[model samples]
Target: MTATVAATKAYDISGNVLKEDLRDIIYDISPMDTIFMTRAGRGTAKSTTHEWLTDTLAAVNAKNAAIEGDAFGAVARTLPSRLKNYTQIARKDFEVTGTAQKTSNAGMRELMAYHTAQASKEIKRDMEAGLLSDEPASAGTSVSARVAAGAEAWIYAPNHISVNQSAATTTAPVSGFATSPVTDGTATAFTSAGLNSMLQQAWSMGGEVDTILVGPTLYNTISAFTGIATRFRDVGSRQQAQIIGAADVYVSAFGSHNIVLSRWARATTVFCLDMSTWEVAYLRPFQTVDIAKVGDAERKALLAEYTLVAKSPMANTKATSMS
Candidate 1:
């Protein structure tokens, strides 16, 4: 129906007065899962360079008959070796202008508080990346920032296995720091056999494997392995049947492992970890502080000083350089 030629309509009015139709809720879909960080143990660190000691028992001998109690010979004793990693600082900061803070917002009531929370989450994500990265430890000079060795740097030969690695590229770090494995830029498909090999290596070293951490791609890849059975649920007439398509727990000869997926994990690497063998040493736990005001703005900083401790690197195994 058309309006009459002389009739006034709402569209004919200039600058119509109407309240905004914005919804009060805000939507965010960013992932914030830090599986490794959440599962690892926590400890306090007193100094910037945190240190821990590890010892190993002597190898077993098949022939130990000492002439049936002949003259007793003293055997040399071995001492525990000390391992150290420098603490790294991770931080995030945000500022909310005085005017913005006072404005009525649709999503959040307090601007500064919202930004502070966001900064905290961002720092956590940064730490997760740092802990899982292949970066080596460095006692930084005046010009560089100190770096803590990650799990990849500490995991060496006998525990660090790989698929399709170049010759002599997979070098173990000296004393669990200061070096990292070199990649061949080649990617190979992840296999159950490769994972089993890593698990076996750790088990042989007296490791009590309990968790298998992987990236999204490998997580899906493992779910499709033939070893994982197709799971079904029995339901009543009023219920819907459920089909479990993903493998959450993997059972092997070594042990049962809880498979954990991490968005921040390296796509080409998988860690078979005994959670007890690892720790995060924190010199300064995560905290927020207000910065000195220079203008009409409020600023805040979120930070933590932490380092990864491979209490017993041999107690963990990893498979790297895979697709």
Candidate 2:
């Protein structure tokens, strides 16, 4: 066979081509805002043992007496109706593996993505869960014990008037209710009268329930509610189409409330919130700490030492049993 001239071959590395569109696409789109909680209040806890007193019960009475007849009569001193505690710590941690720390650069923070914004999201998500749940925390070995008097555990304590799913069952109060608390089952569909009654009851007791929070299921149910006023702009052009089916406001005889659909809220419950009486009492505001080096990995953690403060459980009402 005749010898041939030297042949040339090509390799992928020969070309200086740009990398495939490594566009970091993040799809985490759950509502992570502490909207209802923030609307309630914000404060700094003086110490790990944060305490606040709810105002005395509404007991003003009209009495018939001469101008000076009972002016000197002894009246009982009005003490704080209920005492509450803000003594819970919520925290999370984020660690970067040594390899990831040195070889990751897809998102904004590169290796610190999880440490910064993602870590914040993690903490915020948990806060939302605590804000919307009826969970009770029994101080862990690492965490402080919940104050036993009242407002012991989480933000949405079981103290609120929780209309149970079982209509026959009743929810007893941890302490005397601010007034006659709402106690009604919601295992079925929501009704205009039912909602109106709850609103009226709360309003009568001096609570301004200006917000109604619901889960996706109830959101759809509310959107379909006949009582919800539907407002739309007329698009005269036949070719133009408009989308509807959003419930932004609900006007009742008692008061008008802003309706909000929450992703993290419980599907079986709806909250009639008086945002003015809620608070996020921070023992230690959200901050990141750099851990001491224990391995080749770079370690960081997001920390938030805080607790929910429900000034008065009576100020809020919840409808449970929603299936």
Top candidate on TM-score is 1
Q: For candidate 2, lDDT tens digit of each residue in 1-323?
A: 85444644344434655456677756666566666655758888876555677675646667744785545767777787554443566666667777877785765556676557877877887777666665543333555444221221222324233432354222433443211223335456666555766677667667888888888788777776655655454677666867777887788876778888776677866677788877788788888888876787777778787766677666666666664
The CA lDDT of each predicted structure is 0.82, 0.63
Question: Per-residue error at 79 for model 1, in Å?
Answer: 1.2
User: Candidate 2 local accuracy as lDDT?
Assistant: 0.63
lDDT of each residue in 64-178, candidate 1, tens digit only: 6667668987988999988889999998878889999999999899988888878887888889988988888988999999999888777777677865454313465576464
Model 2 CA deviation exceeding 4 Å by range = 1-21, 24-31, 57-63, 67-71, 97-99, 142-186, 233-241
| Model 2: ten consecutive residues of lowest lDDT | 147-156
CA displacement after TM-score superposition, residue 311 of candidate 1 (Å): 0.7
Clashing pairs in 2: none
lDDT of 1 at 70: 89
